[model samples]
Target: MKSRHDMIERYIGLMSGTSLDGVDAVLLEMDAQGKPQVVEDSFLPFPAGVREQVLQLQAIGHNELDLAARLANTLARIYADVVAQLLGKAALPAAAIRAIGCHGQTIRHAPHAAYTLQIGNHALLAELTGIDVIGDFRSRDVAAGGHGAPLVPAFHQDVFASDTENRVILNIGGISNLTRLHRSLPVIGFDCGPGNMLLDAWCQRHTGKPYDANGDWAASGRLHQSLLQQMMADDYFQLAPPKSTGRDLFDLNWLEQQLAAWPALDAADVQHTLLQLTAHSIAGEVRRHCPQTQSMHVCGGGAHNAALMQALQQQLPDIRICSTAELGLPVHQVEAAAFAWLAWRFCHRLPANLPEVTGAAGLRVLGALYPA
Candidate 1:
């Protein structure tokens, strides 16, 4: 086994979000204070065939554990491959990697039914990489009566907290979530609403592109006011804090139902409405809870979409909008990097879940640990 300290205690964080585009691996080196410094980052594209298989599961009616295991094995192969490549990019040997923080593909997340499933075997990851792996991050929190989503915000507090300034670290990933961080309080977090998931899914279906680059496609089109209003009417938007959701609630089905009455609209118009919906839902939540979260620091792929960012800025005109990069973390690397920080807490038997955020019984170590 590699000596944890001898290995630099550098952790790798891997995330494959609902967008199902690729695997993102972030390398974080912790200082003596346990604060993380981003060492390196890389994303490995999911083979088109693999993505197709994953999406196809959305249509299947029957259940098959054997087939799911097959997918899991293949996925772990790519996951470990991604971890290896990211470490290589950092010019570090695998032996020096202390542990990996992996958020596996979330196929279904329904806390209402007391269940959420994320596939990618931690044991397989440990066996493949010969490094201790920390994953299945959401399950422990769920079992403890938390939403089991937005776990990244706990890590965000550790990395982004400021003593003199209050910060709202809004992560516009597949699902939009915000961490309202105050100087002297535990970070508050919850899933805000749709992020890239809807926009990307819509674009892929209509144009074959994986996502709307900079939301330019949406910018070229006009928002259908009625459709936009109806999309915002989802009950999920009105749910209080301590809640989370997945594609199950805002899937293509939900969009189709809302748009069915107006099938006469142009594809571009539909695209425009989807983008507006994401920005609108998130903006409303910020205004409702953290009215004084005037300094908003955004991180994730959605932060790079110029049109969406512009829309958000207009909604909160009095607030400051900036990317996490401006705060020393890259937009693309924040979520994965948060997991890296979470693993650091896990290794020390420290609590990572925020009860104020996840409604857990209390703070607890949030992931299962695997030995190197």
Candidate 2:
């Protein structure tokens, strides 16, 4: 048998975030030093009808269990397809990969209830892909009285942290979250607020496009300060660290309800204000928690929004801000890669969640494994 120190393992990570945009898959190799090297990756767009069904499930609906289960199976099939594509592109066999880490489609997250659900049939995925699968990464942390989110911060510290300067890794996915890494302080992370989720939903409703490409639509209009203030008043923003949020709190219905107070606002203005809400909320959290942050690195779809980036720059005029790509990981791949790293931690029986970050009972290894 090979000695453990000489062993190398490969993992595949699949992430379908709250953006409801698509699935991101990545293949990575972890060596003895616990460094991950990305081998290959791909993005598979969700089927249009499936995406609609997912969005609908986010709210109260009839037959939701049935709908969620059906969506889980569909997502498994999609994940399997993406895994196959990754294997072919990387020229690796199924047996060569140790396991797959999947962050399933999050339909409802109520960590305060000590329950958060992510649906994707990992057993089915393992069966179809002929590879072991590891999933349900959030529940254990939640069970231990943790928020069970912003889990990626642990991975961020390992891969992106700097020892000389304070840095913040901001992941602007459907919902934005940040990881605070300082040379002297312990790691801290929490959900900042809305990211591309609101912007994309508003863009689709008003312009029929899935998202505000390059944030052009938002840039074409002026910000509505009053409306922005109303949206920012959400209670989630005022909470301290050990927090996480999702579409359950910042969805289209919530936005519409907030807009009820300002009935005459233009659609473009609403989009612009939504953009500002994201920028301001994120910057506010950064200033409040990591005021000494020397720089900020962004990742996820929101980094592609030029106008949003510019707004963020304006909000944090003193701190340097840029994409995670500058640190060797592309904006889109950071989350997926984090899942891959989580799988590595699982296989090694290592603790993945930070007690300081998630308020878990203590540090614990997360995720359950389903063997091939």
Candidate 3:
């Protein structure tokens, strides 16, 4: 007879990044050694209206409290639907899953002010899915006096670290973050300025597409060196580690402000320059911090941008750069799966946040659990 204790415990990780694109969910299984194996992954893009509302809520506006609460409920339902789809695809019952690790949509992340908000009602999700839900994973870290952003480096260390080589796990979502991994060193990580956030926003405005596919539009345009230099001089890029950023600093308004100087520049040229800014900012951090890095494994939406990849390779010719898919996990699955690993850690009462990466007072277990 199969005993409950001897059965495999499954966890679902849900993430909706700053790109405001949509939800990404993944079902994961952990081995006896605490390594994660992705069982299934799924993505559901936000409706245009929903996406717009979320973007609006990023900045202060009238009746935002009411709007944010309503949207949180809507996101919970959306998350529940994704959970249902994952269970159906895997042929598993809700009871078979231990808990879900959900990194809800980040409408605001102000760690310096001592708060970070991610809204997807975990209690409602628990009731709707009939599975335990663990969420609000960042607030506690912020309470511990940490940035509470870029929480995936600990997961990167667990899954991608190699004893024989120094590696950097670069996740370029709406915002880019890199984890510096070495066999004998503490993990170092921080946001690498903007990633697909500015590019996607600019592309959507000019091309009407959510993102620039394969950098086709960017390749069609010319790179403006002056604009790139001006953007690269932003204070955020000059800040030391223990830092993080989102739409709060690198949104459409910020981009427009930068473009205001060059009133006659081509839109595609602006986009091309933005792409270079992302590549340059990321490369600058790697060269400054992880100079000994042998290879950089990239994941997230930016991994698909050929022009950006070429620019990164050009900037750091000494190191090898490739998609994280080369390392066991698929490019899109890394962030979602990291949340699942976080849930597994929470279930075991283990500390998941890296003190070195997030600058917390010390190691701490993240997330709040809502039982089914």
Q: How do all models score by TM-score?
A: 0.95, 0.98, 0.98
Q: Stretches of candidate 3 above 4 Å error? A: 1-5
Pairs clashing in candidate 1?
none
Per-prediction CA RMSD (Å): 2.4, 1.4, 1.3
The lDDT ranking, best first, is: 2, 3, 1
Candidate 2 stretches with Cα past 4 Å from truth are 1-6
- Cα deviation of 339 in candidate 3 (Å)? 0.4
Winning model by lDDT: 2
When 1 and 2 are scored with TM-score, the better candidate is 2
Model 2 poorest ten-residue lDDT run: 1-10
Residue-level lDDT tens digits of model 2 in 1-372: 788645779999999998888899999889888989887899999986988988888899899989999999999999999999889999889999999999999989998888888999999999999999999999989989999998999999999999788999999989999999998888999999889999999999888999999999999999888888877888998899889999989888899999998888899889888999999999999889997888999999999999999999999999999999899999888999999999999999999999889989998899999999
- Tell me which of candidates 2 and 3 scores higher on lDDT: 2
- Clashing residue pairs in candidate 2, if any? none
Each prediction's Cα lDDT score?
0.85, 0.92, 0.91
Q: Which 10 consecutive positions of candidate 1 have the poorest summed lDDT?
A: 55-64
* Model 1 alpha-carbon drift over 4 Å, by segment: 1-8, 58-60, 183-186
Which 10-residue window of candidate 3 scores lowest in summed lDDT?
1-10
The TM-score of predicted model 3 comes to 0.98
Better of 1 and 3 by TM-score: 3
